[model samples]
Target: MSATTLTVRQQLVYEKELCERSFKDFIRLAWPHVDTAEYKHNWHVDVLAEHLQACTDGRITRLLINICPGSAKSLIVNVLFPAWLWAIRPKTRVLSASHSFDLATRDSLKTRRLITSEWFQRRWPIGLRNDQDAKTKFENDSFGAREATPLKSITGNRANFVIIDDPHSVDDAKSAAMRATAVETYLTAVPSRLNDPDRDVIICVMQRLHEGDVSGAILGRPDLDYDHLCIPLFADGVDRPPTSIGWIDPREEGENMFPARYTEKVVRGYRASLGPLQFSGQYQQAPAPDADGFFRREWFHRYEPSALPQHVNYYMTSDHAPSGNNDYNVFRIWAVDHNRALWLVDSFRKRCTMDIALGLSRDANAKTVIAPEGAFALIRKYKPRAWFPENDGTWAAIKSMVSAAMIETKTFVTIDPLPTKGSGDKVGKAVGYQAMAAMGQVHLPVGPIGDEALSEYAMFPAGKRDDQVDADSAIARALEDVIPAWLPIIAPKKKRSMFDDDDSRATSDDCWG
Candidate 1:
C-alpha cells in the first residue's frame, strides 16, 4: 500500500522492510541523524550502494572504490554501511581502518550514533551490548562486533569484513617511505586478518593519492581479483567495467559525478584552487596528469629492436646516491648512431645499500660482493666502448671492479670518470637530454625498459626518483663529446651572387666542405 493509504503502524513496518531490502533506502533513512546538513541525493549514491550490497550478498569479496573527496565514501562505506549491515546480519564482524586511528574512530563514533538512535532500535532492535560498547569498538546482542584501528597497527585482530578507508593521507602520500608503508601493509597485513579466507570481504575506499598507493597496489595485482569502481569528479564517457554483481557507472562523458553539489562551475573553481597535479590525482582519480609533466610524452620516440643501426657505438652511464644517501642506483646504455641520435639500448635500476647494489669485489670467496650481473650482462652483449661512473671518491673502486670483471670475461671496454656539477643542479643536469628528446633525436627501445624510462621523464623533478633521467644526462654529455667523429657535418648553404655565370658557379657542397 502507498504511504498515504497506510496506517501509522503499517507504515513503520513497510519502511523497515524497505530499509532491510534496499541499502539505498537505508542510506536515505539514516542520513539525517548522521549529518546536520540536508541530504542531497544523487545517482552515484545508488551506484555505491549497489556494489556494497553485492559485497553483502557474497558476490564480491574484494571491492575497491576510488572517488573524489567529499562524495560521502566514508559516510556510506564506513559509517552507514556497518550499521545497516548489522541490521541485516547482526552476527557479522567488521574491522574498519584508516591512515590514522583518530580518523577511524571518528567514523566509528558516527556509526555508533546511528545504531543507538531510537529510529534504528525500533525497527531492527539489534541492541548494542552495554559492557562491550566503547569508542573504538563495540559489540551487539547478536555477537556482532565493530572495531576501528589505523592501517599500520592491525595486529591480532580478525574480521569477516575489512574496510580500509583513505589509507594514505594526501599530505603524506608524497613521501616514498609513507607510500611504501601503505602498500606493504595492504599486501602483508590486510589479507591475513580475514576470518574466512574463502569468503571474507575487503573493501578499500579512497582517492588516488600516488601511483604506488594502496589502490594502485590492488589494481596492479591481478591475483587479488578486486572489483574496482573508479568514479572521478567528471565522467570521461568511458563506461566502467561491470562489477561481479553487474553494476556499471551510468554517467556519460563530461558529466559531473555528483551534479547535485558539484556543478561545472564548482569543478572549474576546484581545478583552479588545487593545481593540475593535485586536481588530477584527487578529482580525476589519476595519479599522473593526462598531459605531460616536465617532459612531453609525445617527444619520446620508440625504436624497434631489429631496426638498430650496426654502425652505432654504445656507451654506458651509471648514477647513484653519494655516501649516506638512499637514492636508487641506475645504469643506462645508449647507442649513438651515425646521425647523432641517441638510442636507449638497455637499463638497470635498483634501490639497495651501496655494498649490495655495487659489490666491492667479484671474488667467489666473498659472498657479500659478487659481479654486478645486470650491468655485466649489458657489457657482455653490447660491448659498450666506454663506461662512465660519476667522478666521485668511489670512482676508482668502480673502475677497478669493472676492469677485473672485464678481464675475467675477456671483454674489452674503457672505464672513465664522469664529470659532475654542484648538488643543487640535478634538474640542470637533465636539461641537455631533455632538449635532445624534444627534438626527437633521443630514441627509447620499446618494452618495459622504455615504458619505465618514459614514466620517469614524464614525472621528472616531481617523481619519486630521478636516477634514470640523471643517467640520461650523462649519456647526452658523452654523445656531445663523440658525435663529431661519426656524424657528417652539413654546413649551411652559402649565398650566391646574381651576376655569377651558371657554368662557372661552384657547387654548393664544395663551399661548405
Candidate 2:
C-alpha cells in the first residue's frame, strides 16, 4: 500500500476516489458523451455542489434555487446531483419532476447513463437492479431508486429527496390557469411524496415566470422556511443567504453572472429576443416586469413632498371593486399645477367596507372627487363639491339611490355622469393619459407608494391590478377641459436692414402695413 509500491491502475483508482468526494470533481469525471468538450465549470456550479452536499448531509431540508436559463441548471441539479448522491449513499431514494414527462424522463436517462458509465462504475461499483431498471425509473441493488414523474402525476410516489425542475414552461407560465395549477400541485401533492417528512428534503429549481409562479407562491409565504438561492443572469447586489451554505456573488452590479460563457453581447441578444417582461422574469429573476410598457419610468417626474408647488386645483379619483378580493379599491389625490401638469400627491388602496371608503374620500379634501360606477354610496356619504360617476347603464339606479340618500340624510351630492360606451373605453382612456405621461406632463411623489404605483403603470395591460391605472385615466379625462391647449407660436419674419444681402432682405415693416 506504499505510494512507491502502488500500481498505475491503483493510483488511478485512488485519484478517482478523491474526485468522487466532491460533486464538481465527480461531474468532471462522468460528464456525458455529448458536448464533453464544451463542459466548463463556473463558481455557481461549485456553490450548487456545496448546497446539494448540504442537502444530502441533512443540514438543510427545503431548498429553492432560481437560476437563469442556459446556466446548466438541469445538468447540475436534476442529472449529476442524483447520480452523485446514489454513489455516496446507495440506499437513498430520489424523485425528479418537471412540467413535462419528457423532460423529467430525459434527466432520468442522463442520470442513469452517468451511474452506468465506466468511470462511475470504476469509482463506485454500484450496479442498477436489472429487474427495476427503466428510463423513467431506475433502482440500484442497494435499494437506492430515482424516479421521474410529471408534476401533475407526482402523487402516489414516495422518496427521500424530491427535486422539481422547471415546474412551469415559459408559455404555460404565462397562463393564469396553468400557473395556478402548478402552484396547487406543488402545495397539495409534492409534500406528500416525502418518505420522511421530517428528515427528507425538497428542492425546487426554476427561473421565475409570473408573480404567481410556484417560486413566487413559495417565496410569498412567510410560514414556509426555505433557503432561497437566486442567481440572476446579470448580477444584482450581493445576495447572501442566511444558510449553512453561504454564497456571496463576486460580480459587481449589472455584470454578467457567468461572463466566461454568456458574454455581455450574448446576454444582450437574449434580452432583445425575449423582450423586457420575459427577460426580466426569466433571466433577471425579478418579480416585476422591466419598466418598458405603456408607462416608462423615465416618463414620470418625481418630486419631494415639501417641494411640491401649491396646486391650482386638487381632485380625488377613485376606482372601486366591491368583491373585496384580489382587486383593490384605489383612490388617488391629484394636484394640478399652473402649467396644467397633473401631480399625484397622495393615494390609498385597500379592500375595505363602504364606511372606510367614505372616510378616505372625505379625508382627501379635494374640490372634486371622481369615482366609477361602483362607489355611488361613498360619494353620497362624503358629499364633496362634485362627483363624476360613469353612466354605464347603472347611472339611473345610482341617481335614484343618491336621491333617496339626499332625502334621508339632507345632504346634496353632485353627480356628473361621465359618458359611457362610445370612444370612451377603459383602454382608450388609459392610453390617452399614457400619452400625457409620455409627454412628461404627469408627476409622482418620490417614495415607496410612488414607486409601487409606477411599477403598476409599467406592467400595465399585463399586471394583475389595473385599479390605479383606471383611476389615473379618470383624472386625465376629467382634466381634459382645463388642460392647456398648445398654440403654435409663429415668430414674425426678422426685420431686415436696408443694406442686408438680397437673399436675406425682407420688407417686414411694409409687409405688416
Candidate 3:
C-alpha cells in the first residue's frame, strides 16, 4: 500500500511518535537552555498524554501524578498540554494555574506560541485559530486562554478544562502557610471559573511535600479522588543507586542516569549540581520521605526477627511509634542476643494511651525502653525494667520528673546518619534501608511478639508511612550497647542442685537432643 493509503491506526501511531519526537525537538531545538527530557517527566509526560487521550475515550476524569522535579513535568502540564487540550476538545476553554503568576504566564506564553509555531502550523491548518499578541484563541471552537493571576476570585463561564500545575513554587513548597493559601484558592476560587462541569475536567500535576498546597488539598479529598500516576524514574523505586534498588540512587552516588529515563544521554553533566530536593523531586521522582525529621526509610536492614540468633544477655528495647485516628504511633521492642545479633523481636503500634502501650510492651517481655521524652511520665507509671529517652531538646529537662535512674543516660537515635534537612530522605532512609535489607526486610517472630508491632513493622516502609521503622531504628541503636562484644557475660546458676543437672532437666535439654 502507498504511504497515503496507510490505515488510521498506522497514522495514529505515526502521530503519537511525532508528538513524542516533537517533545524531544521542542526541548533540544526550541529551548536548549531548559533541558526538559532528563528526569522523571519522560514517564510523567508520556502517561499524561496517554491519560488525556484516555479521557477522550471515556476512561477517566481526574489524572493525578506525584513526581519529583527534573522530570520535564512542566512541559507536559504547561507547554505541551494546552495544545493537546485543543486537539482533544477543539476550542475547549482551558484554564491553567501554577504556584506563581510568573510561572503560569510564562507557561501560557509557551503553549500559545507553540500553537502558532511553524511546527504547530504544519500539523493544524492556519485558518482554524487566531492569534493576537501572545494570546491565542480558536474562534471556531469558542476557546481562548491566558495566564491566570493569583485568584481573588476565578470567573470562568467559558473554561472547558481547568489545569492546575505546580500550584506552589519551590520557595512556597517550604512554607505551610503559603501552601494553605494555595489550597484555599483551589477550593474556593478555581471552581468559580468552571463553565462546563460535564465536559470540563481538572488535572493536577504536582510534587507533594507539606499537605497544604493546592495539589495536596485536592489529593486530600476522597470523593473527588483522582488517578494517581507515580513515575519513579531513577532506578524504579530507589533514591540513589549502588543502592539495593534504583540505578542512580543517591545511596550509590550515581554519576547520572546511565540508562536515563527520557533519553539515554538526555542529561549532560550535572549542571552546577542538583539540590537534594530538586534531584529527588525532578529527576528521581521521589517525594521527600521526611520533610522535617532527620530519619527516613534508608536507615534499617530488611531483617526478619525469627531468623535473629538466639543467645543470652538479650534485652528488648522499646521506643514506640504513635498511632491514633490519624497518626500511627509505634511501640517497638528490639532484642540483641548473646551473639550480639540484634533482632527486632516485637513491636506495639496502636491508637491507645500510655497504659495500653506499656502493658503491650511488658507482656511481650520487653526488658529495656528508650523513648522520646514525651513518653517518660507514662512509661514511668508502668515501671519498665529499664528506660532511655532521646537526648535532645528539652529531654534533659524532663529527667527530674522522668527518674533518670530508670532511664539510660545516653541516647543514640540517628534521625539521619548525617545532620541536615531539605533533601529527600534518600541518604538517611537508604542507609537504614540497606541495613534492613542486608539483615531482613521484615520480622515474622516465632514466639511472644506483640501482634500489633509485628503487623505494622512487617508492612512497613511499604505501608504508606514510616512510623514502625523509626521505632525499629531506635531499638536497633539501643542494641549496640546492650549486646556483648567485649566480654560475654554468662549468669551463674545459683546453689547448683539436682534440678539444675542436665540429665534431670529434660525439658531444658530438649533442644540439644
On lDDT, the leading prediction is 1
Which residues of candidate 1, in runs, are more than 4 Å off?
236-241, 250-255, 302-315, 319-386, 391-397, 405-421, 424-441, 445-452, 459-467, 476-513
The C-alpha TM-scores of every prediction are 0.77, 0.80, 0.54
Candidate 3 lDDT over residue span 349-462, tens digit each: 556544344432222455444443324333433323334334433333433433432444233231212222332342353344336435544343554443444443433332
- Give the C-alpha miss distance for residue 86 in model 1, angstroms: 1.7
Model 1: lDDT equals 0.82
Q: Lowest lDDT 10-mer window, candidate 2?
A: 481-490
> By the lDDT metric, which is better: model 1 or model 2?
1
lDDT of the structure predicted as candidate 3: 0.49
Worst 10 residues of 1 by lDDT: 365-374
Candidate 1: residue 498 Cα off by (Å): 26
How would you encode candidate 1's per-residue C-alpha lDDT over 1-513 as one tens digit per residue?
567999878977988999999999999998998988889898889999999999988899999999999899999999999998898899999998999989999999999999999888888888889899998999999889999999999778799999999999988798779899989998899999999988999999999877778888888798999999989887766666788877666767777777768877888898788777778788888776756455778887898999788878788888875352557777778888877888888887777545444433446664333355456666767788888777876665566666765665666668766677562377777777878888988888989989988887766655566888888888776665653524443689978779776755357776566
Whole-model alpha-carbon lDDT for candidate 2: 0.76
Residue-wise C-alpha lDDT for candidate 2, range 1-513, written one tens digit per residue: 787988978977875776657877776656654236577878888888888888987888999998999888898899988988887789989999999999999999988888887767766889888899999998998999999999999987799999999999998987779889999999889989999999999999999877788998898884678888888887877555566566666678887778888987887898789878788788888755557756788998998988777534555676765455677776666677667687887666777654354342332554233343224444443334445455555345345645654555455655555565664555687877898889998999998868888878876655556788887887677766333422233579979778877655246675455
lDDT accuracy of residue 117 in candidate 1: 91
Q: Candidate 2: where is the Cα deviation over 4 Å?
A: 1-8, 33-37, 238-240, 289-294, 304-311, 358-430, 458-466, 477-513
